[model samples]
Target: MIKHNVISVVLGGGKGSRLYPLTHQRSKPAVPIAGKYRLVDIPISNCLNSGYNRIFVLTQYNSASLNSHIKNTYNFSVFSKGFVEILAAEQTNEGERWYQGTADAVRHLQRYLQHHDYEHLLILSGDQLYQIDFQEMIEAHIETGAEISVATIPVNAKDATSFGILKSDEAGNITSFIEKPNSSLLPPWESEVNDEMKAVGRVYLASMGIYVFNKSILTQILEESEGVDFGKELLPEAIGRYKIHSYQYPGYWTDIGNIDSFFEANIGLTDDIPQFNLFDRNTIFSRARMLPPSKVSGTTLDNVVIADGCIVAAERIERSVIGIRSRIGVGSVIKTTYMMGSDFYQTLHEIEDARANGFPLVGVGENCYIENAILDKSCCIGDNVRITGGAHLADGDFDTHAIRDGIVVVKKRAILPAGTVIG
Candidate 1:
């Protein structure tokens, strides 16, 4: 199933302003999720799992960590030609400025793409959570003799307005497209969906931002079009010019657009039967860290997902995700939180020195209660600290943390003093 003729290009999105502190130091793709894996792992894993190995990730904003992660994690055998490389935006002779949008980014990198031998190109977004088989879409594209194919999902009228909706004929051929239409103009845009989807009021076909394109057609469009974005300008124009097909995807898919959605997506992993299954046959590959097993003592855990190299002595932890090398002191109560663990463990000497200086040590201290919060990497919560986040608190950003949509997000490497309380 090695798809040597197809090459994948994952678009590491722009500044990621909506996901602000998380994307402050790192790119969108490098943001951590599920306690251990990065956000970029979703699309790269989908590509690798579908037997397409040649990948080039196009990145522009804060791409150092993303580049390092890909280089260290995805090295194929010397006998195989599989590779995952990063193509950062640079000041070329043709263009000195940065990439303006998605289509502009791909258009700027066409010269580098010419060196690779591929028949079809698979375009993916970096900040989405879904498990899909791109081979099925590719097969449908070839079978229907389509020059371009878009992966679409059935969404309700309310949700369709936020996405690019497409209308397809009975033969699965796309007839028209619109980007984020208004509710008043939605009457004629409803496409046919299955009974199950229709029963749930999901009749509009929304673009998933996943596309398959014949190489020649893609090259031609890029060369002739000066459009900056695909959804905003390119795809809408190509609907009638090309034989575009709609590949309907009927599985679980959620866009990790902002802090609220990102928090819920991680917290959802603690569910008994989560929508995005992580334990399925498709493995999400990441950097293999050599760490010891987690050790928990005197803690009553309920529906929590903890990663490797953790030491916990909490009184109770309910519905939470604790990341690697996390340490929770005795008598703490954690509920509905995501604690991204430390990058490197602190030795006893360092911890003692920090405590002697009246500074908070890395990880949570004794008798702390943290609920509905996200503790970023290497955060130090002192003893007797309490953080209860909910609608009672207004949205604001502070020196140490930010509250958005009733969720408190402690900034990376922030320090909370002893006896501090937040709500």
Candidate 2:
């Protein structure tokens, strides 16, 4: 069975500098998305739904929150030989350093991996949004007898440069591979573009960073090569020496590798029918929390997703994803924003004391006008605050917020003074 043969490893990314402030308190994988679930849940859920239960998450930087979330969320029955475990970077007889890159992270865990009985290792990115059945890819790998199988998708030229490009022969065997190729160096498109692709314009094959490797071949490659990363090092080297194949996935997939992409992916959920459907009863899975239903009073909401325990008294809110336990004051207008909401609710006494001390509680305040922005968890915005991501800022780092792809990001637990204006 696929469950007995495949061991899934989800890579928790390195110090997520691009997703700062959000990554400030939690690891990139632990960062919340779509109101309630964490980013790491995607890959783990996919593996589980696809009949693969043995999963190991590799993490190093800011892993406290990530570890907690995993511990609290994923628990398998002992009767079944299935478990989701965290393999943190540790000092051992083999090495004394942290994970250097993707390959190195897996290489360091070779000792533990050797103890597990499996035929293939499924490598996945922790911060991507998509639903895939790994069984299909596994079957393709077995059918082709491939030493390594890489999952790929068609991407336009504008987005191709951000991913590793690949060229495959008629049999779907990868002939060439390049990491983040320059536009000038990209090979011409050899495959025909379907009508759906034609509507989006020219397209090229791009790696999804999802790989399935034969256990023996993987062990051999890690031991023989000094490559630290898969995309930048190991994969390109394996193109000619090994039986490298490609599996094309024609579904919605987005890599949340940076702030701009993360912002867009979350906001995109407000669509009438999103490309990535969280409401699907069959595919997606995450931590299930038990809390009172969200309460909204005198608020005008449109295309919004309000999570559990949220209290909203705003005048108008449009196209927003409000997380659990969020509080919005009266007369406030939230448009095109993601409020991560709070981890825990403030006690009545704490709110009263904060009010007496002239400090705003952890939420949006009265008459605030916010648009195209991300308010991280537990942030306090005082009365009459206005935040608009209207400026064409490619990138910026400020005291109160950072601007990425024209979206204003207020850091986690940040406090803003009353009547503050940010653009």
Candidate 3:
């Protein structure tokens, strides 16, 4: 039992199409980020920090990575009564259809939800990065008696067209909702960037993709919908009916849907003035000292955010993120890269012209020298390998390996032998 009126549900079962190659072998929520952490860690960690226990993670697609990560990383077993459960869509009496949409995913879990006496059901996507107090949002929802209270973020006008824009009234009550509306078709409140947008504020309220639903209303909507999505089906249908309140969470949040977004979000952590603070004491996000401190000895590191348990040699690492216990070989020069400290080998092994998909890109110097390249997790770089060529690119295929235009994706645990070159 949650002991409270709220139970958090993390929707971890989306087929991440935007993160194609990375999701080729794993789910999007399981994709590695900031070197050592996965995409699911963002919301789960947020839940833990927000003081919301009794969580249920719904998963589809390739979920082995997600399952392993949940088991190994979060320490879910310690909870005597409060537990985190993963509900994978199995062949039931109905049929074995993959999750159709977000609404459908939740609808499938109605059995468990129906049994709970909680007043509110908090639904969250497991792939976003943010640190906001959900307890505050829950309080607001209860105070307003809203049918559905959504968490919203104000995105720049240029980015508004890409999201499911929510047009709300002066009282935080949603008025009009549009899913990825065009510049010309927007409301007058949304401002246009290139003399086109019909809306003002470029400051339209969109879903952080998170929601707090009154359990009764949520059940009613799901029962009516049978199987539908929040963005595509539910929200569109819920307009002008019930109290669909929007809980504005104005904070640092990013939906890591692509390589560029993922890479940039990770690099943002190294900024002198970071927009998103992951280590804030506000208790908006939880803290876990699972790993030891990062080790930097014979290396010269300048302007880098290094995570726990790392071994750095006499290598020069600058403007890069090193994850837990990662090994930096002697004489290796790393720059403008993000490496997950937890996934690296302690020894300088034979690596290939590879990547950790979107993870610690094992960069090697020219002699041992590498420049401006990304290495994925467990990628073996030979004794001497170079991922040279700092050419500006957007999205293209590199023969067998697909680069997101400019980004070089290294697959997990790939081994590149000595004397190799990757462009």
Q: Using lDDT as the measure, which candidate wins?
A: 1
Alpha-carbon TM-score of each model against the true structure: 0.98, 0.97, 0.86
Q: Return the lDDT, model 1, position 369.
A: 99
Which window of 10 residues has the lowest lDDT sum in candidate 2? 185-194
TM-score of 1: 0.98
How do these models rank on TM-score, best leading?
1, 2, 3
lDDT of each: 0.92, 0.90, 0.71
TM-score, cand. 2 vs. native = 0.97
For residues 242-340, write the lDDT of model 3, one tens digit per residue.
Answer: 899888775678888677787778878878877877567754322244666666667887878877777677378887777766767777887777765
lDDT of 3 at 332: 81
What ranking emerges by lDDT with the best candidate at the front?
1, 2, 3
Which lDDT tens digits does candidate 1 get at residues 1-423? 444489999999999988888888899999999989999999999999999999989999999989889988999999998999899999988989888988998898789888989999999999999999888888889989999999999999888898999899988999999999999989899887889999999999999999898999999998878998888888998988999999999899988889999999999999999999998999999999999999999999999999999999999999999999999999999999999998989999998898889988889999999999999989999999999999899999998899989999999899999999999
Candidate 2, clashing residue pairs?
none
How many clashing residue pairs are found in candidate 2? 0
Show where candidate 3 strays beyond 4 Å.
Answer: 1-3, 75-80, 187-202, 282-293, 341-373, 388-391, 398-400
* Native-to-model Cα distance after best TM-score fit, residue 75 in candidate 1, in Å: 1.2
